[model samples]
Target chain A: MTLFFVVTLNGLTLAALYFLAASGFSLIFGLMRTVNMAHGALLLFGGYVGWSVVDATGLWALGVMAGGLAAALAGALVQIGVLGRMQGDELRQTLASIAISIILADLMLWIWGGTTYQVRTPSWLTGGTRIEVLGIGYATVRLYLMVFALSVGVGLWLFIQKTRIGAVIRAGVDDQDMLRALGYPINRIFVLVFAMGGMLAGMAGVIAGSALSIAPGTDLQFLLSSLVVVIVGGMGSVGGAALGALLIGLAEQYGLAYAPTYAAVVTFVIMVFVLAVRPQGLLGRAEA
Target chain B: MGTEALLRLSNINLHYGSSHVLHDVSLELSDRPLGILGRNGVGKTSICNAIFGLEPITSGTIMLGDQDLSKLTPEKRAQAGLGYVPQGRRIFRSLTVEEHLRILERKGGNWTTERVYQTFPRLKERRRNLGDRLSGGEQQMLAISRALLLNPQVLVLDEPTEGLAPAIVTDVVELINQVAQEGTSVLLVEQNLHAALAAVQDVAIIVGGEVVERVTAEALENDPKMQKQHLGLEAAGA
Candidate 1:
């Protein structure tokens, strides 16, 4: 029984991280129709920046903010400097973003070296709290991560569903030309959404890196996990990303507990199964 | 130079890459609705595109009220009080009816959400439905409603009544007349000669990318010989 609770908690924590990373990726791809290969690099870059900031200031919270803001700026720069000039050519966008990822990866290696680094969790989040009902002690930071993910999920849903700009974003995804014709500056909206997506990735990077060591190739791993989440949950939907993350997270945790050697293959198996049955992913519509 | 025409096109020439689409077309619209009629592939729609700045004119001037609109983008033209409902009822399929209206609302406009709902009660009933789920007539209504929300002085409707049921066509024709009666200068393009004759005050016919005939709708409506000569359609209007 205690083992079950532990696995479930682990699953939830992993799911939260996956949701954080995948939500932004799904949103950018869904709205802009651009496959941003640099998303993974952005996550790693954000983690490294957060580590350096904490090393300098000794304040974990400030590191998190700096990481998010820095990633947001980088995201806007990528869109403006590279993707914007591609003029809606998906193939060119993919190639350009892949080139950017390579450049970012090389830059990070030169700046931070190939050695692994992790953030020091602040004192406030380091301890564990006992759950009376489950008769187990859980790390407060992991529990907080779960709560944070849930809150972000709900907050994002509300922002997209209720706000005026949210309506414009939804409309823009369907027909960009129509949105422009309505007199809204679509370029600004694109930049804002791209920045927001990057901020989410950066925040996720900080929280996840604090729990695990981040190294040079860690970007590819997280990017693969996010791709799995997006594929399973359905692209371009906040709710879809959460649900996909939860399913993949549970499968991974359970696999780790039972079939440790095959754990890495479980997510791809599930993605393949889902795709065979439903080509549009779990929650995605057939057409945009 | 005289009183400002609502939408003025002078010596307009356009090309789709190297192929010329419109040649030296000029028009002046004031208070009444103007109808541009032509056979298929005669640049009637291109004229509307020119006025809204959707397709760049190769040479000539497009003036809206007192401002030159030859270089403005589509959105800027829309902000400058030009409304367009392009062909095929180009409604956003992902947005709901209410959302479509909300996205186009301008401050101090005579048209409000409440007024739009009242004007098209069917739209109010389907306010929560996505634009794709609505029937053709409903989509057309939503398109017009979206344009009306901008409170545009000049509204260009490209084939609003096309592919609709005969019954729905009557409803759309009535709606167009109602919009023009409310003092918004309308530029209507229609293949249906009877509907055009019935709804517009003035008519212009284009042949091979130029205006070959410009006359009052009443004059053209009465002249069956002229209609047969230009449109190649026998007297269809009663």
Candidate 2:
């Protein structure tokens, strides 16, 4: 029972990380229909930047903010410089993003080298805390990460549901042409959304580094997980991303605990199952 | 009708790759609502698209009261005081009716959300409903009201009466007339001749992508032979 509880907690923690990564990925896809293959590269770059900021300032929160800002700047540049040029061509945009990912990954490798790095957690979050009711100890950082993810999810939901800017975004998601006809500078909106997505990925990178270790392939791993998560949960839906992340996170942890050899294939299986059962995804609206 | 032109399309030409769509289409919209009547695929919608910069015109100048809109993008054209209620109503499926009204509301604009709601009480009643959830008549009213919130100098409506019940059509005609009377220039594009004639003060008949005739509603109403020659109508019917 204790083992099950610990694994469940681990699953929840991992799910939080996945949600942070996939929510942005799903949002960008929802509004622009751009696949943004470079999302993983952005995450990895953010992790490196966070590590450097933490190394310089010795402030974990500052590092997280700096990392997010760096990623956001990069995301906006990517949209303005590359993606915006091929606005309506999805294939070209996807290809350009893939190329960008390759270049960014190589650039990060050149600068940071092949060394693995971890963002040192603040002293308060360094150790485990006991849950008095269950009499179980869990890592404080992981618990905080779960809470942080929840806060972000709630904040995003409120922003999208209640704010005027959120309404415009929702309207753009529904009909880009109509939104344009209504006198919205859609290109600027696209850049803003991309920057926002990058900011989330960057913060997630910092969080992931603090909770776990980040290496060269960390980007590809998170990217794959995000793809699977969005695919299983539904594309372009925040709620869908959360559900998908939870399912994949639990499945992965349980598989690793119970069947180490086949653990890697578990997430893919869930994605395949979802695709077969519901091609539009669990919460994704069907194309008109 | 006011003699001073509020919107003008001078020597406009549009091409879809190799094939020409609108050829030397010149129009001057004064204070009165002008209707462009034509059969399907006769370049009526193309004219709207050209004005909005949805499709780049081969050559021409579109001026909204001396502001050259030919070079502007669709959004820019919209911001420059042209409100478009596109064909099919194109309501954002994810947005609620209230959101639609709120998204386009400009500060100190002539049309406010309160005014729109007052105008179409049904929209206020369905304020919480997603755009796609509304009935066809309700959607049309929301679309019109959404554009009205922009407080545009000119409102372009494409097929406002299409796919509507006769009773709803009557309501839409009344709404168009009311909108024009409120001081906004209207460019109405429609296939329904009676609805167009009833709503607009003047009518332009487009045949083979060219304006074959431009006459007052009264003149077109009295001349059934002209209607049959240009619009393929057996006769003007009630």
Candidate 3:
């Protein structure tokens, strides 16, 4: 029972990471319908940037800012220089993004080499003050992540519902042609949305790296996990994505606790089951 | 802006690939509804698209009052006093009816969300419903309301009464009449001759992608033979 609680707590932390990473994936997909295969690369690439900042400036806050800004800048440049010109052609966008991911992954390998690196949690987040919650003393970072994740989810919901820019974004997501017809410049909106998504991915990368050791093939793992979250949650639904992450996170925890051998396959099983039952995903509209 | 008429589209030519879809089509109009009538194969929707700058023309220009809209993008043209309600009531399925109105806001002495709701009381009742959740008539009403929020001097609506019930069609015709009364130039395309004659002042008939006949609604009612052959109907049968 104690093991179950601990494992569940750990899973929730992992889910939070997945939620942040996958929401960005959802936003970019929602707007342009372009599959950004380079998303996980942006995460891992952001982690390295954060790592470098911590090494130089020795401030965790500075590292976070640096990582986020770098990711946003890179995302904007990639969309404008590579993907923006590929509008109206879905196949070309997919091929171009996949090609860019391959090149970026290779470049990452060349620069960082095939070595595992641990992100040293800043002193502020390193140790947890003991707390007895139903006869279990878990790390404080787990609770912190949960609160932060919930805050982020709520903030995003409000931002999309309450702001003028948010109205335009939602409109764009529903019908890009109609929004453009209303005198909104869709190309500029595309760049801004993509950049915002990258900033989100970067934040997730920084937190995940600090919580767990970063590895050489972290990009592939992040990519696969993000894909699972996206599929389970529903492609264009932000609220669905968060719920999917939590369910998968909790399920993975239970699998790892009781059936350790089945932990790796838990997400895949849930995704397949959901797909079999409802192809449009948990909350998304059916494709016509 | 010239007071003679709100818009004058002169000698417009549109080609898709090597084939020309519109050949020297010119429409001159002011505050009254100009009904664009044609057979199915004729390019009625293409003309609307061309006027809204959704499709590029091979030659000629669309003048809305004083501004020349040929060089501008669709968005710029929309901002420059030209509004469009596309053939299909292209509402956003995920957004609520009110959200759709809010996103298409423009500054001028024009329609606001409240004013639009006042014009379309049905929209106010279905304000919170998602676009897909609304009925066809409601969707069409929202589309028109959204376009009106742009404060356009000239409004071009393509097939406004297509796929609507007779009663809803009457309501739409009434709305168009009310809009014309507000002094906005209206270009209406309709296949229903009875509805067009009831709702419009001037009418143009398109044949082989060009205006074959231009006349007043009274003239079209008078010449039943031309309506029979060109409009694909027999007036006596009706």
Sort the predicted structures by TM-score, highest score first: 2, 3, 1
For A89-187, candidate 2 gives per-residue lDDT tens digits of: 999999999999999999999999999899988899899999886779999999999999999999988888899999898888888988999999999
Least well predicted 10-residue stretch by lDDT in candidate 2 chain B: B229-238
Model 3: per-residue Cα lDDT over A69-138, one tens digit each:
7877878888999999987677898788788878887887898787876555677677774656658776
List where candidate 3 sits over 4 angstroms from the true fold. Answer: A106-114, A129-131, A251-265, B1-32, B39-43, B53-72, B163-167, B207-211, B236-238
Clashing residue pairs in candidate 2 are none
Q: iRMS for all predictions?
A: 1.5, 0.7, 1.5
**Reference-based lDDT, residue A231, model 1:** 86
User: Which scores greater on TM-score, model 1 or model 3?
Assistant: 3
**Alpha carbon lDDT at B11, candidate 3:** 97
**Candidate 1 segments exceeding 4 Å error:** A1-8, A127-138, A255-265, A272-277, B1-30, B38-70, B121-133, B163-168, B204-216, B219-238
Arrange candidates by DockQ, descending.
Answer: 2, 3, 1
DockQ of 1: 0.54
Of the candidates shown, which would achieve the greatest lDDT relative to the real structure? Answer: 2
lDDT of 2 by residue, B1-238 (tens): 5579999999999999899999899999999899999889999999999999999999989999989999998999999999999999999998999999888888999899999888888888999999999999999999998888888999999999999999999999999998899899999999998999899989998998999999999899999999888888887784
